[model samples]
Target chain A: MPYVKIELTREGVTREQKQILIKGITDLITETLNKDPHLTHIAIQEIDLDNWGYAGEQVSVLREKGITADKK
Target chain B: MPYVKIELTREGVTREQKQILIKGITDLITETLNKDPHLTHIAIQEIDLDNWGYAGEQVSVLREKGITADKK
Candidate 1:
């Protein structure tokens, strides 16, 4: 059983996006790792901005300073 | 870096319980795997019953059929 977990900031991601993520990950695992798509379990965790930290600062605080994790 | 993800049904789990889980898992990994607690990341995912599947059925369906996953 291949279990894949994706954690992201709770940035208003839709249910359809989550479905696509689950399906895409399952397909990738099946193709590369030879895992069964039916047995693959994928979970997406949408963490709160205050709960997620990076570089010793909370995401919420970083956002206040116009800093973000996105590469743009 | 050690990353641990815990997934459970969205069944009224409190924030305190999640804190406990994160701390406990970090300690366990530090002690057993010699991982640094500072480098350990723990995430808890609360999933909807209809989104989690087991045994060819969703958890919501299993609950309706009186087939609970909890071990007594």
Candidate 2:
């Protein structure tokens, strides 16, 4: 029942990568949060750079400014 | 962390309503998914009626069709 949603700028991630990311995150949730992996729900939103803003800047600009530079 | 994401058609829900929904969902997650409330992450996306679809119909139409009519 724990649902996780991720909103990010559209990128070159493939379906395989998406699956891996979700699995990894779900595994981490089970380990760190003591959650049941079977019941966890995850959703990812691929948003346009212009549509997602942070700190008064679009995600693209913020990435260039090193805001999300460390996040892979 | 167990992250929960909810995407729904935009409704006239207030901030208090939003908070209550989040809390209730989080509590359910804790009970059902065995997650810790402190580490659980929940995100809600409010989309226009035209943006969300289910079972070959928009959420609005689906609701009228009694698909999501039972979900409060």
Best by TM-score: 1
- Candidate 2 differs from the real structure by a C-alpha RMSD in angstroms, to one decimal, of 10.6
**Which candidate should be chosen as best, given lDDT against the real structure?**
1
DockQ values per model: 0.12, 0.05
lDDT of each: 0.75, 0.67
TM-score of each: 0.56, 0.44
Looking at model 1 chain B, report the run of 10 residues with the lowest lDDT sum: B50-59
Give model 2's docking category. Answer: incorrect
Give a tens-digit lDDT track for model 2, residues B1-72: 675566667766555555566667777777887876666655556798677876778887775666654447
Residue-by-residue lDDT tens digits, candidate 1, A1-72: 976667789878775666566666777778988876678776666789999999899999999999877778
